[model samples]
Target: MTESNDGIDRRSAAPMYDQLRRLIVEHIENDRLQPGDPLPGEHRLCDQYGVSRTVVRQALGQLEHEGLIERVKGKGTFVARPRTAESLVHTLVGLYEEVERRGGHVHSDILRHERITADAEVARALELDEGAPVVVLERLRHVDGDAWSLSTTWMPEDVGTHSFDVDLREASLYRLLAEQGIVATHGVRSAEATVATHEQAQLLGLTAGAALLRLRSVSRDESGRPIEFFVAYHRGDRSRFEFQLDADSSRGELIRIP
Candidate 1:
């Protein structure tokens, strides 16, 4: 025990509560205290630091707010276990695969899957003329058994045909597509913050006028062939996006490609 910490004489110049909070946190950071370790009781803290009960409580409040400690209902205040990295949302790893990795239950329900003529937007994205044959697949995704997002895919006819197999209901569609020879090697993605339409909101079991994430992307195969055009409506409350940035030494990065 240090002489100064044991008898911390409060000066009129410095605030006592904030100083106490920093002193306690520094002890934790230096491995003097660890998670699951108990903190001194409120009365004991007030006595040790020579501070008022109010000052001790206020300092503890800040520590709890910062997630450095927790006050259990019956048990006394204890250090908190730090949180680990969690995925915000879908990336190239496949939506189903990514969610499970984050400790969330995953499910996909095929709402509609059909072969139809391409609409104007689909035609343009797929690089096909209007009325070209296209396979459209609609799916509702659930995370932890709650409705989370909706995905719609438009597969150009040049891509392998789409079908409604049992795997589509309960497995990764990307893996299924890979087995069928339409491997999605890479994609060009665009994301924007948007409000859900009335129809979309209803399907997602959300309020009629709600905010959502509108994600769209075009995936291609090894030969640089545009095969799949996908639009996903992700719930803002239940979804987020993550980006991994690494140094790219190769200056050959394609600029203005979007």
Candidate 2:
């Protein structure tokens, strides 16, 4: 092992690659490197840390996998921007309201807003009979002018009729429902990892098979009746979900997802 004067201690039991990874993390955490800042190239890193090219490559690969850095084919590697953090474990807020609360802009492009027959899955989620008439609203949501999520919502025909009168591109579904005496007081939400499909990829500006976070939720009104069911796909690389757990409680409290 080559001795390193720049914090890569060859005498330590830890591996050289791991030591380098920690060093880079420290630089990022200490603000020595800011987002979009270019990192040293492989050759420069090899000389600066007195390590082999293989060690540097391993460290950079690990960092890229962890979303701390991004490597451009010709522009070299740069520090990655922070992911958008959303908390669905504590508050019942929509994406538009949440992003606006954080001083970020939010908008949506209405894709589909017509009444359609509810399929088996949508019917089950909304507690309606199969083949029942339901309102389907699809939107491609954007945050700060970047494609963020694709959301599809289903509601019973009676409740969704009010939506046709409003321009949903700039409207909030929950607020619209509230105006019609349907308020979502609580909901059950679940999240899972999924790959972007061809259609979804095109709408979200990602390649097919890219990582995505799928969020499904069933919202109930104050009367304990299911009023809304929605499925949303969020870009995994740009979005992150946060949760707060209490050791004393057996079940974690979850809020609604928009």
Clash counts per candidate, in order, are 0, 0
Assess candidate 2 and give its lDDT: 0.83
TM-score quality measure for candidate 2: 0.74
Question: Which lDDT values do the candidates have, in the order given?
Answer: 0.73, 0.83
Candidate 1 accuracy as lDDT = 0.73
Q: In model 2, which regions exceed 4 Å deviation? A: 1-33, 37-61, 70-78, 252-258
TM-score (C-alpha, index-matched) for candidate 1: 0.61
TM-score of each: 0.61, 0.74
> What are the per-model C-alpha RMSD values against the true structure?
9.4, 4.9
**Which candidate comes out best when scored by TM-score?**
2
Candidate 2: tens digits of C-alpha lDDT, residues 1-258: 223456888889999999999988887777677878988888888888889999999999889768788665547878977788998534667787778778988789999889999988998888889999999989999998878899998999999898999987777777787888888898788888899898998888766776789888888888888988888999876787887667876676555433
Candidate with top lDDT is: 2
Q: lDDT by residue for model 1 over 46-134, one digit each (tens)?
A: 77777889998898878865667766544687786553333433256567877677675678888888889998899888889999999
